[model samples]
Target: MAGGLVKYRHLSRDSAHRQALLRNLVTSLVKHESIHTTWPKAKEAQRLAEKLITLAKRNNETSRRRATGILYTPHDLLPKLFGELRKRYLERPGGYTRVLRTEPKSTYDQGASAILEFVDGPKDLRFAMTAAAVARDRALGRKSNELTLKNRSKVLRYRDNGEKAFDDMVKRIGKLDLAGVNKGGADKSGEAVA
Candidate 1:
């Protein structure tokens, strides 16, 4: 009820989910200087990444605090943000990042995906990859094959007693191959293959 008028991508997730997405994307962008994600996600992360870069440019206590609240770990994030990235882009007057579309689209959702990278940065990524890939690439000073799961479930759901019986029945039926195997009985088709 508080923000009923507000508008944002639902992404089939609740408020907390959206916020977490933003935080992770921004963090990745800072650490990697580039990231690949769905088109919509890239667009949304661009807004936040630019703002964070602007804060890095400011390089003040208050700005650092604001960034840390969103970024987590002021010591780690703020230093690199205000130090290296800030120095690199200090002369630029905004438009800090660019989103380039990945040809052939994405395999996951079949929606357009993009690589969002800092201006005057690397531009020849062969595939659209997750932010974790970008981070690993940075750490290794070259691309790495490592992958990290982003959306891990925080809640566990258990079936009730009634549901458990149906689940068990389905599992048993799944293993009962319907053809090309003997079940200690004749074919129920009332016929045989020659």
Candidate 2:
């Protein structure tokens, strides 16, 4: 069994706890459109969340029943799940969710962290990041690099009038005085500069 393929991470929890945990994560994801958690839990919950979106896309009785079963607050979420999310991802085939890794929340905790999010929504991190990249390049009087160009195209691929939205975001971010932004008055050395 040492060389055998593993199916999924157990996350040191038994089956019931794991299911409930994933259900809660997915429910919160539906409610908020994004969530931050430990990387393994994000990965596992991403799987279930994607399947639930697929069910929502299907928009049939069986799929609705399954989605209801998976979500903790189905009464509150079923409408958004079956209506808004369905319309949002209708044309896309798969990959509804994304997982981006991050540093641990604090120095004392070293577990790998990640953000699990539904893409193409109002709170899309990729879209915002790509727009920032474009704005930065423009502010520097330089053309976008290959990676920036690729990300720009990718983030704009699905949304309605994505180009316009990207342009608007770029314009808005371009107007910001990034040099004046600070981390709670802390400068490079974590000393007060305000």
Candidate 3:
């Protein structure tokens, strides 16, 4: 009735409930950048977030207090948010928030759900650094595997040559002939036959 369709009273019908809902929505938006809720709540959250961003862009004491009062964020974080983030988005106009529709909930009045989130800045440098570290580790692992294989092959070659050396020694020692007679057969010195 107030803003078309059914508005989410969230049980209570007082100003406290509205303020509490707004604070909860803002906190969730800041922490996760997205939240799923009923359509009206999502729309309300989007409107609130846009206003907060506008105030953040202003970067003044009055604006900070006003935004903090509405969103219930910590006063300490306001300076950082305004000083750093505000300057970054000075060129941009509005549309600081986005809403997306999600699956409908089966229970709790079967309300259709949607997600609200803030549009953040570009990709962080740490992500690229982490990727580089992973690639370096993978390369090192491959090199270590290759080195292990080479060492194993060298050990196997040594073992094979050692076996061949033992076989050569046995051949040089020759076989004993116990069947021969002891009375100097053919050669008196008992030398082997040519």
Candidate whose lDDT is highest: 2
TM-score winner between candidates 2 and 3: 2
Could you tell me which residue pairs clash in candidate 1? none
Q: Write the per-residue lDDT of candidate 1 for residues 98-183, one digit (tens) a residue.
A: 88888636566688888788764433232222333433343334543433222111000121232343334334443453332333
TM-score against truth, every candidate: 0.56, 0.90, 0.51
What TM-score would candidate 2 get against the native? 0.90
Q: Write the per-residue lDDT of candidate 2 for residues 1-194, one digit (tens) a residue.
A: 57788799989999999999999999999999999999999999999999999999899999999998999999999999999999999998899999999999667979899999999999899999989888877765679899999998888788888999899998889768343334355544567764
lDDT of 3 by residue, 1-30 (tens): 466765444534477777788778876775
lDDT ranking from best to worst? 2, 1, 3
RMSD of each: 18.9, 5.1, 26.7
By TM-score: ranked, best first: 2, 1, 3
- What do the candidate models score in CA lDDT, each in turn? 0.63, 0.89, 0.57
User: Each model's number of backbone clashes?
Assistant: 0, 0, 0
Model 2 lDDT, residue 189, Cα: 57
Q: Give the C-alpha miss distance for residue 87 in model 3, angstroms.
A: 4.1
Candidate with better TM-score, 1 vs 3: 1
